[model samples]
Target: MDLSIRVIRSDEWEKARELRLAALRDPVAHLAFLDTYEAAVVRPDSFWQERTEGGSEDGPGTVRQFVAEAPDGRWLGTASVLVERAGAESFFADVPEGEQTHVVGVFVREEARGSGAIDALFEAAVEWSWSLAEPRVERVRLFVHAENARAQAVYRRLGFAPTGVRVALHGSEDAHEVEYEVLRPAA
Candidate 1:
């Protein structure tokens, strides 16, 4: 349960890439993610390089990716949060002009599941989201597949409540992703 949680570094792009590919190959990948291993693998190295660097601590202030590194240095899980701009719009919902972090791309190795890695990753992500300055983060949100009960339970336990806003799934408008959020208390 003593996992090392921290932001990934740009130099560790290869490791990050490997873990992501592994995640995409999981049985639930279709329901859990928008992209597939085949598509990700076909992308040029420069894409991975830029993606890794963008999620690194040295990257822009709006995006962050965290990884759970086992004691032996292997990555056991990963989570990413993207800060949304209300004026610019977001991939799934409206940002409302205040700072908000959209959590996504969550994954944990099968062997690492049920060991608090998911909780640890969420803690890191929520902590980082609230730590931002400037506009200041007002809330953290994420979308979960309607059928992903496991993920929904975890999010509820972490204090994210359903926002009553749902988005249609990519290429499948009839199916929807449920939106949830944890609002930061007003001062």
Candidate 2:
């Protein structure tokens, strides 16, 4: 099965919404996403439109969403990255004093697991981060739920290493998200 990996376009908002809803319903959604399916489902269409537009290729480079689409046009998986600059207050984890990209909204269909789609999605996301011009990204990072060993293994296999940083989730110290990162490759 051939899968094309590419950044999403603004007009594809509905498709993006569909994929996100499906992802939120996945069995591991609780551990993989901070947002709940119930919450996401009730959001207005405008919310999805704006979200997709901001993460689209035609939008500002601050965010980009990549999708793996099969020949039949179904999205096999999706991933998004957000640029966090130095001295800025990030909504999630704190960053070092440098610009970096944060990966989020990662999801792959259960049937698509083990199909290299995840690797391809990450490759596109990381490449997009390194391609930014102004305040060039210094590294690519992501937060995985502390109990999510399945995701940890995949991230490690993809060359991401734990940054020895962890952040509380939903103001609960008992639940945390561990940070992992990969520095920009030397030119």
Identify the candidate with maximal lDDT: 2
- Whole-model lDDT values for every prediction: 0.89, 0.92
TM-score per prediction, in order, is 0.96, 0.97
- Across 15-53, the per-residue lDDT of candidate 2 in tens digits comes to 999999999999889999989899999999999999999
Residue 22, model 2: Cα distance from true site in angstroms: 0.8
Clashes of each: 0, 0
Query: For all the candidates, what are their Cα RMSDs to the real structure?
Result: 1.2, 1.0
For model 2, the superposed segments whose C-alpha errors exceed 4 Å read none
TM-score of 2: 0.97
lDDT of 2 at 52: 93
